[model samples]
Target: FKNAGFYRTVRKNNQPNNNFKIEVIQGGLFSDEEIKKHPGIRHETTQETGIKHLDGTISMARNEPGTASTEFFICIGNQPELDFGGKRNADGQGFAAFGKVIKGMDVVRKIQQLPDENQYLKEPVRIISMNIR
Candidate 1:
């Protein structure tokens, strides 16, 4: 997990109190090619974990419309919109969340406040630490 990329994200969740931190490990954030072969693997993994919405912590990845690679985000809020809205899979289903942040939330807030261009952060936030559970 030490080598994985870290991202600070803001969620467009329905709740005003929605916002938090998340960390992606298993080297998932560093390769789009790797994810192409196992589409929706993250979503499946989340269901098995039985944890949805770190409450405030959020996670990010490329939008479901295409292949998601080295970019990931943290939940700044509860993003129900991401869960539904006719946003289906190949068969038409909603996207699924994979993981959450267990610590380092202050880092997320700092990253989100960084300057951005066209909404994408001008500079990618750095990962302070990552650990496998």
Candidate 2:
């Protein structure tokens, strides 16, 4: 759905100046009623390789309590602050990570360093296409 714009950036409820450019690994299923029920579906120990708990690592986005969908991102750098209960998840929970970039490190960096004056891209990132394997 992200590729088709079904979902929008996970903007902070109150902080109107902060948002992340996360990647949606599998997007279409997000609108599916049954799938939304499983929030912990794509997460594992944050120590896994490629999907390690590093910055620039792409992962799944979820609601505060754990409502994951097909959306994910490549952490531009090490962001333990976004880890479970870190600054980003001050509520004592955090976003679920599902995958990482096997390629495209440059793209991730570019997106991360973008002029996020409002904490979100003035021109938001858009997915061109998606595939499943």
Candidate 3:
């Protein structure tokens, strides 16, 4: 992963509205390329998943309809505008909701309360490791 960090609680006009996300680099960090060398998975919004951007919901981040890499986010509030047919983006194809926080919502809220500037955490919360048990 090229980047893995929590989003700032404050929102900027030009920033993508999200709570936290881990950016997965397509190519290794050493290569000086912005996009991936090989074509990655292009998940198009064929149909609505019927998932809403409610609090604690986890979803994939994508610029276009498809082209979702390993980047993802966790919502801290009821972001209904991020749903399909919502006006968050011009395309109207909102992010893909895949999961939610089943426990430890207090930790997520604490992370969201961190200090930040321009949607970037002033003192980033380091994640040593994430164990999925």
Which has the greatest TM-score? 3
**How big is the RMSD of model 3?**
6.0
Residue 58 lDDT in candidate 2: 56
- For all predictions, the C-alpha RMSD in Å is 6.7, 5.9, 6.0
Return whichever of 2 and 3 wins on TM-score. 3
Overall lDDT per candidate, in order of appearance? 0.44, 0.49, 0.58
Off by over 4 Å in 1: 1-50, 54-71, 84-92
For model 3, residues 8-52, the per-residue Cα lDDT tens digits are: 444333256544332211112222253365344555341456777
Model 1 C-alpha lDDT versus the unseen true structure:
0.44
In candidate 1, what residue range of length 10 has the lowest lDDT sum? 18-27
Error of 2 at 47 (Å): 7.6
CA error at residue 5 for candidate 1, angstroms: 3.7
Off by over 4 Å in 3: 1-3, 10-40, 44-47, 131-133
lDDT of 1 by residue, 10-78 (tens): 323222442422222112355455555455534332344444544433433555533444445555545
Worst 10 residues of 3 by lDDT: 22-31
